[model samples]
Target: MTSFMEDYFRTALSKELAIAPPERDHEHLSSTSRLLEKQREVTEAETLLANQKE
Candidate 1:
């Protein structure tokens, strides 16, 4: 689980690094995608942890 979180963080960081300077709508879309990805990672991690508790 720790490894999974670490991987997700790394991927997010890479994506952020690769993002070019926002020019127009692309900027908004990129930001939104990143936010959604992060949210999904958090949700998945929480679910995994919860399952472990049971």
Candidate 2:
């Protein structure tokens, strides 16, 4: 589940990065990228915690 979320967010980040200059907002883009990365990390940690309980 965590790996899946990480992959999905990475794909989304790539798509967002591919936009042309005139269509992109650098600040918003950077914030979104950072947020996605953080979310991915949290998901991975949660998955690890869950697995350790088994």
Candidate 3:
């Protein structure tokens, strides 16, 4: 009985969480690219600021 309940709960939980559109690869790549671009910009600004202070 416990095994049966475990299987039932597992199935229900899986179904409840199986709720994504699965287009995450493309979305994630774009998000990563945007973040990397922003990081590069910030690094450039920091270098310029240090150069001016020196």
Q: What is the C-alpha lDDT of each candidate?
A: 0.68, 0.67, 0.67
Choose the strongest candidate by lDDT.
Answer: 1
Residues 1-54 of candidate 1: C-alpha lDDT, one tens digit per residue: 998998788668756775443444535567778787668669877965775674
Q: Which is better, 1 or 2, measured by lDDT? A: 1
User: How well does candidate 2 match the true structure in TM-score terms?
Assistant: 0.46
Shift in Å, residue 12, candidate 3 = 66
* Per-model tally of clashing residue pairs: 0, 0, 0
lDDT, model 3: 0.67
TM-score of 3: 0.47
Model 2: per-residue Cα lDDT over 1-54, one tens digit each:
998898788668856875332444546667777687668669877965775574
